[model samples]
Target: MPQETFTLQIRQIRLETDDVLSFELASPTQNPLPVAPAGAHLELHLPGALQRSYSLLDEGLGGCYRIAVKREPQSRGGSAWLHSQARVGQTLQAQAPRNDFALNEHAPESILIAGGIGITPLLAMARRLNRLGHRWSLHYAAPSPDRMAYRDCLQALAADGHGSLHTYCSSEDRRLDIAAVVRASGPQAHLYCCGPAGLIDDFITATQDRPPERVHYERFAARHAASTEGGYEALLARSGKTVKVSAGRTLLDAILDAGVDIPYACSQGVCGTCRTRVISGTPDHRDECLTEAERQSNEAIIPCCSGALSSTLVLDL
Candidate 1:
């Protein structure tokens, strides 16, 4: 797989519905898209917009990369800019592909549950599985069929006899039952889910009894925020260097300000690229990338966007 910077032109942009836009980005070169897994996402640097992570929707071939963007009315300009400001023919900087969510290699069957825009990554997975002629099923739940992104693509997959695709529209019917569907999916099936907070929470609660390791999930929203010092001190362990960051400044910013270079992306803490070992002090882990156990162990921290709570944090640097 190739990992190189590319400028992608917005060859086409279609409003799938009032809240979603299906953007088909034209590649600059002829190389095929990297072989991305089910839950892989790319970092997009939209001009004048903050770096945001978007799940890859393309099947890793074709001349273009497709992504579905949901208009986030509550976001701080990320989704809003993507929906309102982005125009066709415009080019944007984007990274190739990265995967945090992958499939269970040895599993015989898999079940995919998607909520709203969370369907983007799973859609890619479904396409890949269909291409390989594998056994899988997808249950997609949305507020309405009109608001559902990539409805045509998913429909085509179902039409081709790839797998069963279930659509649950909650607007017209008050009794959209996801629990029953999940229950019938059977045990030993590798399950993957993505989407909004309410849906993710419901699914997590619904399938809590499943094998803890088999349930793979990812959050599109930022994780919990704690009352850290607003900012704190980061000590470079090897160099014996110290940098003070006030409220609003991240530990990565403080280190880079002191002429230290650390790899990072999606500074919002979604990508685990900037994760470094925590040598000492209390780490106020605020990243969406690490699990609860990883944070508790104090083994690593994403300093690029994470902060310190103990006033002084020693980093492996």
Candidate 2:
């Protein structure tokens, strides 16, 4: 099944940094969009079927949703199009906002780490925390000050006693030490990080001693390298259909080719949209969303980047 979508008009576009642009989006009819919580993301239906997800900033900004994008010349077309072609007053189709990186404003302590353009969602969390008078801090890092987005806003938030801001710019000889930061935080502090793959991996490794519930992260791209070494059968228990996953092919494509409908976004498995229940069989979990305990239970699977450890997987499609 497809998600419901609506038209959003680009009201403003501001250069946040050298490569990052902030887009302000609102309903075409000037209606207020749904109240998006901190860390929520909106899926933009771009031209050429290139759907991309961007983090919704914390502030509503008078009912308009704000998002920041960093132009990636080497990657897919989303960022490139938005940077070189998109203009204010243009309308775009978008899916309803969804959140996998929700912030816990009530936590006793919140520590946010952002690298480069990954500051999008954490900026929202900082504002919400400031408004609620909660204790929080943001550590933002970029190669240079010219590339750090939201520097003024974050500085203002800190200057007003809302929260504290710490910045690290490699060009100035200050480097962010993830392990040191993790070691310094209190054990109970709810840590959140969104950044490059190396940063996320370092954050996870540094926080391994803390309670899993207290550590959180969001990735714009999949961390795991998906393998196509399939030698299993996916049995759709409810539909009474079986799809043979042969080597050099993915189970998701095979199942979809068999005329089965499965909702998926970010085919890379960073998004948990395709998580499905497993009636039986152990899943070779590769998704970043599933916790270790869930993988051990073998009760669910993310077929987008996962496969079966067992010869047959009875899926509850």
Candidate 3:
């Protein structure tokens, strides 16, 4: 299915930090927006056909959506454009909320670990957990207090005894011990983390002994793809066509260039929207969406970022 775009009026804008800004969006006609779960995200369709995803932070707020944007020093103009050009009273187009990191409500306990801007989704999780009277804790880390968003709100939660809030500011020589945090969560606790590659990697390593289904995480960016020496052939079984997937180009791009239409979001392969059945092929899977079992089955491929291990790959469509 194709994504439907809706216009959102910017209701408020606030500077959360030196490099971060929070934007509040509402339907132009005051209609109620779709309610999203704890860890859902909205895709903002920016100018020049650029789309960027931001975690929805307005947990308890109805009829409104809130998101925080952090200006990346090395951004390709997305954050910079929002920080400089976006303003209150302006209307922007956005897609409906979607979740790839959903909280397990039935878990005995929940542990949320957030780093810097990664706090967006975790904040929502905290609020939802508090509302449901569920046991949860948040471990937030940032370079400094000045760079952290929603500090006062998190502190308020701590003061109200909703849950424990442990903060680590690297500038103050406080480092987050991932191993200790995981161990402290206990065996029955469900752990969720979102952050830079280093923090996520360490968290995964620390929790390696635990059940894989009990640990969840989401990454803002995809890992760098390894280089391939030559191009591969992709056969579109339904269309009865063969396209060459170039060394540097993705299988998705090759298919699109051949005039095939497909549904896709977060072309980086994190959304699992571009997953297509594999008629016959050994896929060199690079997507984070598939699990070990799915990868081993070779039943589908996320063409947006994955490639073929065999010389010729045949796809269902």
Q: Estimate each model's TM-score.
A: 0.87, 0.93, 0.92
Per-model CA lDDT versus the true structure: 0.77, 0.86, 0.85
Candidate 2 regions with alpha-carbon error over 4 angstroms: 59-61
List pairs with backbone clashes in candidate 3: none
Error of 3 at 66 (Å): 1.1
Among the numbered candidates, top TM-score falls to: 2
On lDDT, the stronger of 2 and 3 is 2
**Comparing 2 and 3 on TM-score, the stronger one:** 2
Candidate 3: Cα lDDT at 36:
83
Q: Sorted by TM-score, highest first, which candidate order results?
A: 2, 3, 1
Task: Report the C-alpha lDDT of model 2 over 1-317, residue by residue, as the tens digit.
Answer: 55677899999999887888899999889776777889888888888777788898765668788999999878588899999999999999987778888898779889999999889999999989988998888999999998988899999998878688999999999999989988888877999999999999899899989988889999877777775788889999978999999988777788888898886767777777778999998888888877789889999888888998889999987
Q: How accurate is candidate 3 locally (lDDT)?
A: 0.85
Off by over 4 Å in 3: 226-230, 237-241
Global Cα RMSD, each model:
3.1, 1.8, 2.0
Please tell me which model should have the higher lDDT, number 1 or number 2: 2
The number of the candidate with the highest lDDT is 2
